[model samples]
Target: MRENLAPVSSQNMAFTDCTKPTDLSTEKKRKNWRNRIGFLLKTNSSESTLHIMKNRSCRPTADDVNQWAQSLDTLLSHKYGKAAFCVFLKSEFCEENIEFWTACEDFRTHTSHKELVSKANSMYEEFIKSEAPKEINLDFHTKNAIVQSLHEPTATSFQSAQRKVYSLMENNSYPRFIHSDLYKELCDAARREGKHIKS
Candidate 1:
């Protein structure tokens, strides 16, 4: 009878290694990196949504249709206005402003220090860094302020940049979106449906 065959210890090293104790601290680091990657992936998905919305015109409900016709402040304040404005920015190929503004809004809701830092870095790399893909037009002072705050990012790190973008949209893009055919069609539909528009 032939001797019973046995697996070599070296051959079983792979299986043994799989059962080794994992470093808890290292595991935590891995999880943090994963969260960071998730943040970036989410950002990409947002742009994808913008692309989709750009292809289709907005259809506002009765309550919001009249809100867009009001002052820019009123329009920007309402959820419907923000959505419509994003579509308008996408159409203009300048959705970065709105994206940055939205990012800022998200930052305000963060309570964890780790999450705040991670998100702030992601935003800076994506929208604030030189030659960043989504860099918005910002004044020297505003850019300088953002750069200084990166050392220890806070919720307001992007405050100056956000304000500048908001002003740009309010003064430039907001007016144009109001007159766009998309807006006109939405307004017309509301009227045909007998929706009362606020003067």
Candidate 2:
């Protein structure tokens, strides 16, 4: 008989190296960077066009964002309006208002009928539905209008509802966001870092 083979035990086989545990802070930073890149890609073309418009400038300084915070009208009227509002809202725990508003904005940009229908349905399900995770506060009339519009999706189908939510945030949430300690901290941090107002 030939020599016998050895048993496949740890002593016989080579051991594989173990990977080090991941740093949660590093992972979080990586995720944040990825999200930032994704947002930039989504708004790249639109932002480029707006960049050329002096009044709608996309590159805002810290002071500009601070100034925008002084009035809800000024903040929402900016080309990158959601940029600052979203950051502020996140801190105040009222981010759904801006998220729904921005989703409506993106919904209106779809040119294809199929895409319009798809996005409209998702938007309605997510924000207009009574118990949706991100359900928006809407009046009965506005909610009914969205229900009727779902049959034939159009660019402006969500306009009325969007306007209502915009008004709600502007009147109710904006004042608190502007004066919150988070706002002051953001401005202070920006001043120290010498970075543009990105949120």
lDDT, candidate 1, 1-199, per-residue tens:
1111112222332122112234545455344334433311212466744653453234345556677778777776776567666665665567787889889999989978888888988998898655579866664556667777877888788887788777777777888778776566556655643432233
**Candidate 2 Cα lDDT to native:** 0.62
- Which residue ranges in model 2 land beyond 4 Å of their true spot? 1-60, 76-84, 194-199
lDDT, each prediction? 0.63, 0.62
Enumerate residue pairs that collide in model 1.
none
Q: Report the Cα lDDT for candidate 1.
A: 0.63
The best candidate by lDDT is 1
Per-prediction TM-score? 0.64, 0.62
lDDT of 2 by residue, 100-190 (tens): 8889889988999899989998998787766567766665566667778887889999999788778778776777667765455445643
After TM-score superposition, the amount by which residue 43's alpha carbon in candidate 1 deviates from its true location, in angstroms, is 31
User: How high is the lDDT of residue 77 in model 1?
Assistant: 74
Top candidate on TM-score is 1
